[model samples]
Target: MEGNDLQRDGVARVLLWGAVLLAVAAGMRYGLLENGLLPRDCLAPGSPVAPCAFKTALVQSFLHQRLGWVSLVLGGLAFATAGRRLAWAGWLSGLSGLILYSYEPAAVGAMLALLVLARPRGEQRH
Candidate 1:
């Protein structure tokens, strides 16, 4: 029974790492798609950015990308770890990653958090 619990814990950690990576990729895609773009013709070398494009930003796009990257590294650590405590660490990272990184499209947010919570946080065999 103990062995089985450890095995399950191992699996959970991996899932959390996967979620972190997914969040990073999603953040990048969204950030690039929505950026400040000057009008096609209203550029003179250092012209101000157009209003329509600039206003499109939600600030979250920029922040989420950075947060996502950090979360991924933390997730990786969690994945490599084999203990219940580490699993919780990964879960926390995933939840925070989801909160800070997820934007209007909340599906990813919920998914990331769920994955972290469900993933195997292994046990340290003493």
Candidate 2:
């Protein structure tokens, strides 16, 4: 396949934006325990109204932290590298985001990352 490689100019811009999202996710994962949308902590806590205490939550949160770090690294790589390969990395990163939602971030981050990956290919172009 020819892939999306016509020129590599857009990847860096995309990566820069993805980097911003990653930083945001990182901040939320490390700082926030509240989810405005959900009425309950799905991870469970000592009290229903209290923050999470489950080892599962702790583990998931750590995984999310790692995802943030990976996103940051991938963003830098995308910015530094050329061609559609960067887009593939971004696409993969987004897919990963969908799987990790600690601090309620991954869903939106996944969408944004997909945009970064697909924009140059007319998937998001306006």
Question: Clash number for every model?
Answer: 6, 0
Q: Write the per-residue lDDT of candidate 2 for residues 1-126, one digit (tens) a residue.
A: 245653563666655766775676545444453344223445444535423434345346447465544544554455444325654554445544543442234333344445455445544323
List the candidates' TM-scores in order: 0.32, 0.32
How much is 35 displaced in model 2, in angstroms?
19
Query: Lowest summed lDDT over 10 consecutive residues: which window, candidate 1?
Result: 103-112
Q: List the residue pairs that clash in candidate 1.
A: 12-119, 12-120, 13-120, 82-122, 83-122, 83-123
Residue 43's lDDT within candidate 1 is: 41
Segments of candidate 1 deviating more than 4 angstroms: 2-64, 83-86, 102-126
Clashing pairs in 2: none
lDDT of 1 by residue, 1-126 (tens): 244453454555545565676576556445443342323333457555654344334334346464445445544554455334444544544454554444333333333344544543353435
> What lDDT is reached at residue 4 by model 1?
41
State the displacement of the C-alpha of residue 57, model 2, in Å, after optimal TM-score superposition.
Answer: 14
TM-score of 1: 0.32
Local lDDT at 76 for model 2? 49
